[model samples]
Every structure is written in C-alpha cells, then in structure tokens.
Target: MWIFGYGSLIWKVDFPFEEKILGFVKGFDRRFYQYSTDHRGTPENPGRTVTIIPAKEDSRVYGIAYKIRDSDIEDVVSHLDFREKDGYERKSVMFYPISSDQKPFEITIYIANQDNINYAGYADLKDIAKQVVKSVGPSGPNIDYVFNLADAMRTLFPSVKDNHLFELERNVSALLNESSIRKST
Candidate 1:
C-alpha cells in the first residue's frame, strides 16, 4: 500500500512504513483548511482535512511517499476517514520524484469537497502564523503541528524557506502571551 503525505505526516511518522521516495505533486497546492480537532481539538471534536488549490507558478510542494504493508492499509484508511470526516474522499495523485534518478509515482491523496469544507487558500507566513497561534483542535493547539511541519520542511528540503511558518511561530507566541495575561486578569 502506498501512502502520500503533504503536511504533518511529512515530519511525524508514529506508524511503521517504509519510506519510498521524496516527491512532488503538480497542479495542486497545500493549505491548512482542514481543522485538526483530533490533533488539536477545539472545545469540541477532532477533525482534519487537506484543502487543495491551484498550484502556483514556480511553486512546488515537497512531500514523502511510503509503502505500507497491505494489512495496514485498512487501519490507515479507517484512521484517515475518521480524521477527514464526511467531505473528504481518497483519490489518486501523480507524484513526481524529487530525485533526478527516480521516476514519478501514482499514489492516493485525500481531497476535500469544496461544497462542505472550508478552504484556507495558500497562506502566507504571517497568515499561517496567526492561524496556528489562535487555533485549537480536539487533540491540542494547532501551533504544535505547524512548528513540526516547518521544522520538517527545513530538514527535508534545505532550499525551502517558509517565512509563513516563522511568522506563525512569532504570532502564536504573542497570542499565547496575551492569553496568559487575560487568564491572569
């Protein structure tokens, strides 16, 4: 079974799977539209989604491909289903290998249905930072996931610079400070 990761999964792999290749998917871009209620639950429930938008010119997203045991596919799918909720459906994606030596691979990607889901467009560093700082999900605060993704992006692709992530960190810090002051008052 093949697994494609574009966000937090790129850095944090709690499950076991063989890493296949680092790759890029063209014609689509990533955003934080998916609410992470499970990972960072709001006052209520857990949820998440991947909002795909038109890929920007000269912009390519870096992600990882994994080959998992066939038996594990069901479990992963179930877990993803729970995370994504009713609006997302699993579909095939063409992933171009990042390495000069490797060929492109076709894998599955979870895409959100625009009719029911919110799309957070390609967020700039400041926007993303602000979102990360202010958002909370069922599992925890959203900023933790953002920081991890930013770190992973830097570690995996040295050339990639995410000012939005940096801005997110700074903004979140300020928000946290304000929250503390409010609580104290």
Candidate 2:
C-alpha cells in the first residue's frame, strides 16, 4: 500500500517505508481551510492547516508518496489513523511521479472535508496567516508547520505551483516580520 503526504508529512515522516516518490495527485487544490486544534493550536484558538479541496478544473498537488512494505502496512496504517484522527478521512487517489519512467499508482490520502467538525472552511490568506502566527499546540508553534511545509515543497518540487500555499507562506512571513519590527521599535 502507498500513502501520500502533501502537508507536514512531506517534512516529518515517522513511519518506515520501502520507497519514497515525489509526485502529485490530480483534481484537488491545497488550501488552508482546515483548523489544527490538535497539532498547532488549542481548542480555544485553532491554527490554519492545508486540506485539499476538490477543484472544478484539473489541478495537481505535489508531495511525497511512500510505498509501505507489506509487513509494515498494518502498523503504518494504524499510526496514520491516530495521527490524522482530528478531521481527516482516508481516500485513494492516483499519484503521478515526477520521473518519466515511473507509472502512476493508487495511494491513500488524508483529507479534512468541509463537513468535519474541525473544518475552518475557506479564509483569506492574511486571516489564515494571522491564525498561524499566534497559535501553538502540543506539537509546537503553528508557524513552524507552515514554514516547514512551504520550504519542503519549494526545495523538493520547484517547478510545481501551489498558489494558495505559497501565498499563505508569504503572508505568514510578512506577518512575522512586521511583528518582530514592532517589538524592536
């Protein structure tokens, strides 16, 4: 079985896999529409996180795909299930690798749909940035999550464009800079 990681999973992989491929899945647009109360914020104030929305037009979200060893499938799946229990549900999608010689294959993705209780559902980049800047949870600062995922994407797949994600990162960076400037002054 295979698993896809488009967000934090890109930078933080706790599970063991036989192989990893950098690729993309179609028909979805990554957006900061999910609230991360468990990982990046408290229940009182939630942090913004990426959750793929079904796009009207064909869209591609680039990320890493891990091929689980047959023996480790059970353990890996169980770990992911608990980690993504907040509002995410597992769905299978085709992953297209960057290499030309590789063929597309089905992989499991965790998606937090609008119906989920933790769903923040569509907010502007600045608003999302503000939330991310101030929130922190058991996992640590929300800002780190945004920065890490953004950096990983740019470093791993420079050609692919994820406007929402990149724009959010820019907005968050600006907010942080402004905050530091204000503090210094």
Candidate 3:
C-alpha cells in the first residue's frame, strides 16, 4: 500500500515504509484551509494546517509517497487513524513520482472534510497567518509546522508551485518578524 504525505508527513513519517518517493498529486491544490485543533492547537485555539482543494485547472501538490509493506498495513492504518483523529479521512489519490521510470499510481491520503468542525476553510492569508502564529499543541508550534513543511517542500521539490502554501509561509514569517521587532523595541 502507498501513502501520500503533503504536509507534516513530508517532514515526519513515523510509520515504517519500504520505499519513499518524491511525488506530486495532480488536480488538487494544497492550502492552509484546515484548523488544527489537535495536532498543533487546542479546541479554543486552532492552528492553520494544509488540506487539498479540488482545483479547476490542473494543479499539483508535491510531497513524499511511502510504500508500506503488506505485513505492516494493519498497524500503519491503525496508527494513522489515531494520528489523524482530528478531522481527516482516507481518500484515494494518484501520485506521480519524480523518477523518469515511475508512473502515476494511487495512494491513500488523509484529507480533512470541509464540513468538519475543525475546518477553517476560506480564510484569507492574513487570518490564517494570525491563527498559526499564536497556536501550539502536543506536536509543537503552528508556525513550526508551516515553516517545516514549506522548507521541506522547497528543499525536496523546488519546481512545484504551491502558491497558497508559500504565501501563507511568507505571511507567517512576516508576522514572526514583526513580533520579534515589537519585542526588541
């Protein structure tokens, strides 16, 4: 079985996988439209997190795809279920690897439902940035997730255009800088 990780999964894959491939899923755009009330924030203070939205044009989300061993399927799925307990569900997605010989294949992805209570969909960059700046939870700071994922994606697949993600990252970074300047003064 194959699993795709376009956000935190890119930087943190706790599951054991036999193979990991750098890939992109077409027809979806990664945006910070989900509220992270579990992983990076509490119920009262939700953080901004990435979720795929169906794009009108041919869009792509670049990330890592891991191939799970047949023996480890049950355990991996169980772990994923608990880890994604906030508001995500399994969805089949096609992944196209960076390798020349690799062909696009389907993999399961944990996508948050827009109707879920934690869904922070449709918020502009400024609002999302503000939420991310002040939120933190068991996993860590919301900003860290943004920075880490943005850094990872840029480092791994530099060609892929995740404008929404990069824009949010820029806004977050600017907010952080502003906060630092305020404290210094």
TM-score of each: 0.76, 0.97, 0.96
C-alpha lDDT values of all predictions: 0.67, 0.91, 0.89
lDDT of 2 by residue, 92-115 (tens): 999999999999999999999688
Q: How close is candidate 2 to the true structure, as a TM-score?
A: 0.97
RMSD of 2: 0.9
Distance from true location, Cα of 101 in model 3, Å: 0.7
Each prediction's number of clashing residue pairs? 17, 0, 0
- Residue 92 of model 2 has an lDDT of 99
Error of 3 at 141 (Å): 0.4
List model 3 lDDT by residue over 49-116, tens digit each: 88888885577888889999999999999999998877889999789898989889999998888888
Give candidate 2 misplaced runs (Cα > 4 Å): none
Question: Which is the winner by TM-score between candidate 1 and candidate 3?
Answer: 3
Best candidate according to TM-score: 2
* Model 2 worst lDDT window (10 residues): 49-58
